[model samples]
Target: MGINKERSAWEKVNMARAQERPSAKQYIDRIFDNFMEFHGDRNFGDDPAIIGGIAQLDGRSVTVIAQQKGENTKDNIFRNFGCPHPEGYRKALRLMLQAEKFGRPVICFVDTQGAYCGIGAEERGQGEAIARNLVTMMNLKTPIISVVIGQGGSGGALALAVADEVWMLENSVYSILSPEGFASILWKDASRAQEAADIMKLTAEDLLSLKVIDRVIMEPNGGAHKNIDAMATILKDRFISTLEKLCSLEEDKLLMKRYEKFRKIGYYKE
Candidate 1:
């Protein structure tokens, strides 16, 4: 979507969560040549909320990791509505480490409301798992790129987003928390989520201006669901161009720039 100042942030939020919007599986199919999905975290089990694998992007092998949500109630339950657990984060990190080992570029897609907050998830060390991903990705040797294709909420999204470059779809939102959560915690009124959205600066346009994201991938006039092919085409081009630039750098330089990218993400004036 083109930058539309008139579109309220909350409306964009709704669009990002639309069921008809093509999910990570859809994007992976269209953008990559052959995808071989890997399973399990080695310790606990496999997680459907996250899908990771080896794929050929423009004839170059790359690791593809993405958070996935289902289109219907049954599938959503199976996927935990794309809210991953500790195992999901571990799976992502494992695939990332594999990428580093094979000298392959890592591409991540973030689209989660947050990690699963259920008692069972906490019992399995969800926080620790997410934290480990952050530490590992920060120092990983391979070039990495992450795109927020939909709801990138909380630490769950951040777990997969510590990359050399982070992009966001025009209608997507990447925030520390949902506006409802912010309003509920701050004002004790979840109904004031619209108000919270106005101040959160979660939109791709807002994030790019704030230096929170590297670029904004334009969607259709309404959203990605309006024209999935067009959206994926633009996204594929951006990925290829960026990957070429990143893969050209020396390994040490690649790591340094990724480090500096996060260090420079602040809202203050120079």
Candidate 2:
């Protein structure tokens, strides 16, 4: 199982914000009902890294897209450790478009280290795929919400994060670059990853303070994995409330609000 042993003391104290899990798929499957999974990018083979389907929450239908990582070596190979290729983002874009056309509220769960950086993915237009998704999500006319349930790094997270509202589980991390990646580039030492993580201010609380995230979803005392049912219930309630609020707004207003939310992300005065 993937473990987080290098976190600082403060991070350990906040570990109750969300539970460390062997995998998020289990929690999602247990919480959602009547889920019908979709497959394939249509132009290319399906990417297991991105999973999307229609499901019911409290008997209300919604579309969900989640980045799925694996628990074991075999599953990791299968899911690509939640690192998606170009086709995976394409598939996500297709689902988002479908949700928009049908006027369904879309919910996305982000849990990726980043988009796959393999030569094959680049050759297949990885940059273009992520860029296209970013634009499409920005202009999407439906009520869309994204939750960063775990690791939300680089372009992979951004692809699904351009929503009407973005939430992050208290323990989850979201950053433009992974700590190790940043450390390698800035310090020429991957060993400085912990320092990079501290400096990135990627925690939910930090992002909330910066207004980069709409809210910090509380997790169980010990973590989400410690009490999956409680976490799921809280998530469901929050999602319902947020969706109702978003749905009440006019389409133009909703779009403007989303645009303004993003535009104001880096606002600061010296």
TM-scores vs. true structure, each candidate = 0.96, 0.90
Task: Name the lDDT of candidate 2.
Answer: 0.81
lDDT of 2 by residue, 212-265 (tens): 888888777657777888888888888888888788888988888788778884
lDDT of 2 at 86: 92
Scored by lDDT, model 1 comes in at 0.93
- Give each model's whole-structure lDDT: 0.93, 0.81
In model 1, the clashing pairs are 1-219
**Ten contiguous residues minimizing lDDT sum, candidate 1:** 261-270
The digit string of per-residue lDDT tens for model 1 on 1-270 reads 258777899998998888997899999999999899999999999999999999999999999999999978999999999999999999998999999999999999999999999999999999999999999999999999999999999999999999999999888999999999999999999999999999999999999998889888888877889899988898899989999989998988888888878898432222
Best by TM-score: 1
